[model samples]
Target: MPTNQIEVLGHAISNGKGVQLNLDIAKLHTRTKIQVPIIVERAKKEGPTILITAGIHGNEINGVEIVRQLVSKKYNKPECGMVICIPVVNVFGFLNQKRQFPDGRDLNRVFPGSPRGSLASRFAYHIIKEIVPLVDYCIDFHTGGDGRFNIPQIRINEGDEETLQLAKVFAPEFIVQTGHRDKSFRHTLHKLDKKVLLFEGGKSLHIDDAVSKAGVSGALRVMQHLGIRDFSKELESMDAKIKKPKVVKSSSWIRATYSGMFHPFVKLGSKVSKGDVLGSISDPFGYFERNVKARFPGYVICINESPIVNQGDGVLHISRD
Candidate 1:
């Protein structure tokens, strides 16, 4: 509860000061040192402490960009509380452009891990031991896996009204009410009574300008709402189209019935009626083709951008009544 005892990576950071520390835990097969940089900023006055993190899945480039922009723009500097930004958590995977650690483990699936565990587990354990205790709230950014492109949305556990309100303040196109994944970073934080907003947008290995803007604007808005800083001028300049996030209580995937070239018809976050043509699949040759139709009325939250898909592949994610 002491304000003066703010230490990261064993270095003390006094009030009204900022520091850049590195988590150097492992080495590559070639003995190259990979350090994960963590940026910290604090205010003289005491307030909530929030940690902004990205790249749990290293190939999620848009998430990394969002946190990077926050640090480069000095948006992480708080006027009251403390702001900790870890732009890329899985430096190993990041360097290799992979979604998992070098040891073939998903960094997100191993949380609050053991020191003697696998490479990813050790990294998770270190983070939990050295950093997570200091955080009051967290915003973990991510993009869809593989070729799935997700509309900007905030995902939180159902029945957490406080977190729901914060998601509302984030103002993404949709707020997905979902259950927590076992051993996920969000799940670990939730157990520690830390509020976390899991942001999903764009797609792995690619960055979209609209997704970046949505992410940055949402973080600024959340920070302002938390009284960490005032971003009125910044937000106004961005001219972001802040949506009253539609709370998605339930959703379902529309899978492909045929295998072939995939072409989507509707835009991201667009609403459609049942039986609408969401996309089409055709054989590489002109021999076969089929149109995919919606089974229910809802907003399209995700679209598979892959040029080719197999039968039973989930081509679109739509909200359900």
Candidate 2:
């Protein structure tokens, strides 16, 4: 409840220029000691504390790059607030280019975690305890998981007008009104009345420059809108306008019926209708091929680009009407 100063990693710094600190892990072996990295920047003025986090799933590199570019820029001095950027929340998974933590846990799924639980859980608990309470608004960045690709989009909890408005300010290609699942960080923050916007773009392990630029611009736009920054000259020129996105109540995955090489007929962001051929799965011999068709009309928001697939593996995702 103090205005002039805040404590991060047990180090108190008066709110002025900005500060960066690493959130230490509970047990640090030489191999894992460097896993937790959280950077906080508090402005000299009193304003809303906004958090920008990425790499909750580890392999989502676009979000990581977005945070990097945002913090590196010399913007209008934060006149009224602070910006906390946690570029890599799951460092172990990132090292191996995996989606989950080293303990094989999906960090995003386990939120408001227990300090005495597993590694991922403890990390989550520490974050909730030390970081979540200090922020007024949050924006978590993400991308499609390994083997999957996504069009740039913002996912917000349905019916939260403030969060919706914030998402619109980001102006992503799509705005998905989704509900929170139990134990998600977004859900936990929502319980505390903090509006957190989740942005998803590109594919895991790959850098999509377009998405990264858009993401950084989006965050700056929000900052400008929130009065953290004075001007939008930097953001105004970037392509951060809201596009009417396809709204799906839910989405379903199209799985491979047999093991084979895949040929996608549509790319990410392509709109499709019922009975359209989304792709084809062909046998190694090329003697047999099965057409993958859209079950309903909607958008092809995600598709698997791995080229090889096993039977029943997720191949494509459609936002159904």
Candidate 3:
């Protein structure tokens, strides 16, 4: 396949160039057509095709910003192969600033979707048809949803050497072995035998500058690893120092046992020992307080930012050390 010439959304983008195209997905109640933005950059040299996708959950804006920072500059365009970036996949949910589609469906759960399915499924189906087949690897950006803040991390299916190495090259604080649902994009891509790395950080609907910066740099490193650019020169130019992430096979979320005003003692990325007090939950009147403790030795990867919590709500997520 020619790396220089590529077609997307009925438009042909040629070598050493870039193009922004709009893909029509649906119509609003007011009869306005909703078009998803796609940016394609093809290099003059042949190498690998990588897909950078974001905003699968519309409330997660960090990924969107990461994508923006990546494609904003002219020089950042690949020197070989091609880069196809979809900054916001859930246009409807993004506009509404919600996690689910207008039909109340989680878009990420329905992938390689059906044409006759719900709006989310149809939109996903279109993306799988149009984008998935063209890419050699995929990097899906995400963040913790529902008031949870996560340390910058990479999640990949365990035992896939190619994908694992790609995740390592990205160099997040942790590399988690996570299983995806049957209809998820990750699962579908794995079924098609494509290498995938899912990078996650910060929180939904909020931006952490450090996490955003890390995301952009990690993606560039992955591009370098794929031979999209000169490796050592690119790293030196980027001032990128690679770190080996702690690889974990499993993790757990600690749930709140008492409903009240919670005060956290540890922030994201805090290391903790088994049975250490993580936080305190007290009544608004300050009559009594309950301590939330870690169940095992690990590092806190995610914490609930919201002070108010109910019984049985997930308060913290730990990746075992």
Candidate 4:
């Protein structure tokens, strides 16, 4: 790899150029190989490279759509930096319409993976080895997993000022300061001194048009703030509004007490106080009802979209100061 050239998915993209390439990961039981698409837009001048990854979980399609919209419509060879967009990271999960790999592993939880590890692990290793080392920033898009719906928001590591500032540029409705989890892409990138912003919106396996719109605009705003895109002239020309996303330091999930049909009273983005009646769970016969209350004061960031839930199922996610 030279200073003026970048290689991805076996394609060498030189300065002032863009290319769509594919990297083959492995051969399935059917002897068919799986490959992921990669799009790189390199600038002619010296600047940073921002990596935008989506669809790590196959079911999280809103982010995938957002990346599609950006790369297809909004992206250009940056005036300064470069843009690397990988619209679908998990080929198996996306094809199977699943959140986890066929082997029951969460791809997002297997970062800096082993080259000779499981399918998910190998994919993670490939990204860490080939992609993560080349980028200065990362914007990973996601949605609420397991039948949950999330308000459009940006999730960042706790107390990271630079990344926090970038998240602010996106100006989603909420900015969550969460601790880094083990084997997560954000944590791994943080360890390498690369700032990664996790954008959470919509629901798994479904597309919300409004959420998609928000996601697309948020990403453009981030690029604008980074000097990769023109904000006022271009965004305003498209009637985009940049609002300040509120920051919430703490959050918790409300779980079901027993298996039943859950009827949620509060919706996503609803503000709640301690002991607020968030929802109710009842048996099929209308007996054995249990009220799910808010344990602390916070705003509702995520809610279960599915009516049926099992005992100990997370129904709502709340965020508080």
- The lDDT of model 4 is 0.86
* Model 1 TM: 0.97
Candidate 2 clash pair list: 47-80
Evaluated at residue 57, the lDDT of candidate 4 is 91
Model 4 reaches what TM-score against the true structure?
0.94
TM-scores of all models? 0.97, 0.92, 0.95, 0.94
lDDT of 4 by residue, 1-321 (tens): 245677766677788888877777776778888788888888777778899999999989989998998877856458777899999988789999998876779988998899999988887898898888889988999998878999999999998999899898888999999998999988999999998889999898899998988888888888877887675676777676777788999888888888999999987888899999988999889668989999989899999988899988999999867
Report how far off residue 259 is in candidate 4 (Å). 2.3
Off by over 4 Å in 1: none
- The local distance difference test score of model 3 is 0.86
Candidate 1 per-residue C-alpha lDDT over 1-321 given as tens digits, one digit per residue, 9 for 90 to 100? 367768789999999999999998776688876689999999998999999999999899999999999999999999998999999998878988999988899999999888899888888998999999999999999999999999999999999999999999999989999987999999999999999999999999999999999999999999999999999999999998678889999999999898889999999989999999998999988898788999999999999999999989999999995
Give candidates' CA RMSD values in order.
Answer: 1.2, 2.1, 1.7, 1.9
Instruction: State residue 201's C-alpha deviation in candidate 3, in Å.
Output: 0.4
Backbone clashes, candidate 3 = 0
Q: Which regions in candidate 3 have their CA more than 4 angstroms from the true location?
A: 231-239
- Give me the displacement of residue 221 in model 1, in angstroms: 0.8
